[model samples]
Target: MLKLKLYSIICRKYKFVQRESIRSNWMKQRKRTTSATSIANINVH
Candidate 1:
């Protein structure tokens, strides 16, 4: 019972960290794409 409880706690923490990393990565990608598109638009105009 104790081991199961500990395992669940660890799994939850790991999942939280995994989610945070994914979110940050997504934000970085979004920023990169927006900047690139803006630059492209400036060149076109």
Candidate 2:
């Protein structure tokens, strides 16, 4: 019973970490794209 409880807790933590990493990566990509577009707009103007 104790082992099962510990395993579940570990799994939860791992999933949380994975989700956070994915979110950070996505935000970085979005920022890169936005900056690129803004630069292009400035060049056009």
Candidate 3:
């Protein structure tokens, strides 16, 4: 149950980060790079 909760939290956080990344990507491309790195980190871990 605890693991499920953590997973849900991570999913929520990922979505939030994704939306922010998209918004910032319009102004600067750097954010997309960071977002890509974060995705890799998440997938790796």
Clash counts for the predictions, in order: 0, 0, 0
Cα error, residue 41 of model 3, in Å, equals: 44
**Residue-by-residue lDDT tens digits, candidate 2, 6-28:** 99999999999999999999999
For model 2, give the RMSD to the true fold: 2.5
Runs off by more than 4 Å, candidate 1:
38-45
Every model's TM-score: 0.74, 0.76, 0.56
Pairs in steric clash, model 3: none
Error of 3 at 35 (Å): 26
lDDT, candidate 3, 3-40, per-residue tens: 99999999999999999988777758767677998999
lDDT of 1 by residue, 1-45 (tens): 999999999999999999999999999999989899999999999
* Predicted structure with the largest TM-score when compared to the true one: 2
